[model samples]
Target: MTASTLSAHHVGITVNDLEELLAFYRDVLGLTVVDRFAVGGDAFADAVGVEEGRAEFAHLEAGGIRIELVEYDPEARGSPAAGLNQPGATHVGLAVDDLEAFYADLPESVSTISEPRTTESGTSILFLRDPESNLIEVLES
Candidate 1:
């Protein structure tokens, strides 16, 4: 596509556990796995900004949102996930008809920042971290 024809693409998240994260998205979140592939070598490393990086990647999509999961070389894993307030960090937001019910149904392993609360705008919202500490926002639809 030309520069003037640019459009939105997928959001990429580097993960420590590809399989687990893949399962979380595909099973728990109900996203469909669209593609899976592996890449490595100098070109791959240069393109991904990881030195000597080889990675397995999966693309998942549903409800018009697409996500790309990348697992870097096993021996050279990255650091802990960044907090939401940290620069350059991004979080995913989702809507549910019943925020309280959704929060209650979440697996015990999922850690939330706090109980669901009503914001100034009157939207019931909650924040939870995924297995890998990636922040997610859940709001009442």
Candidate 2:
């Protein structure tokens, strides 16, 4: 296998609140909802290693990148841990045309890690948590 032969399919994020997270990604971030669906049954349970796997899901696309948001059944769900230093913790980085406008447009309820800052390389980046507390990094393209 080679890197050239591989391409990104999508980033899967597990959320507790489907509607809230969907609103943030779709309405707030302006990502287009490509598709929405629900999954369940014995097959899904076996694949996910859950006794009875079931969930609602949505796929949003932005700049050719797809974000798969999943809201698992409450009975089969676990709480999210905090901190980026933890193992297996993942954050999605997105490139935006206007960093300032993007930051300003974010709702006040959105918890930002800090104000947008430019690095020595001249790339502007900011960090914020989604409705489900998933860390998202927005960078100026």
Top candidate by TM-score: 2
- The best candidate by lDDT is 2
What's model 1's lDDT at 105?
Answer: 84
How well is each residue in 1-141 modelled by candidate 2, as lDDT tens digits?
Answer: 765777799999888788999999988888999999999999998998777879899999978989999988845435556678887778998999999998998889889999999999989999999977899999999
Residue 103 error, candidate 1, Å = 1.3
Tens-place lDDT per residue, model 1, 1-141, is 566876778888888899999998788767899999999999988987788989999999856778899888944645654787777778888778998888888888878999999999999999988788888888898
Write down the TM-score of every candidate.
0.84, 0.89
- Clash count for candidate 1 is 0
> How many residue pairs clash (N, CA or C atoms closer than 3 angstroms) in each of the candidate models, in the order given?
0, 0
Candidate 1: global Cα-lDDT? Answer: 0.85
**Which ten-residue region of model 1 has the weakest summed lDDT?**
74-83
Poorest 10 consecutive residues by lDDT, candidate 2: 74-83
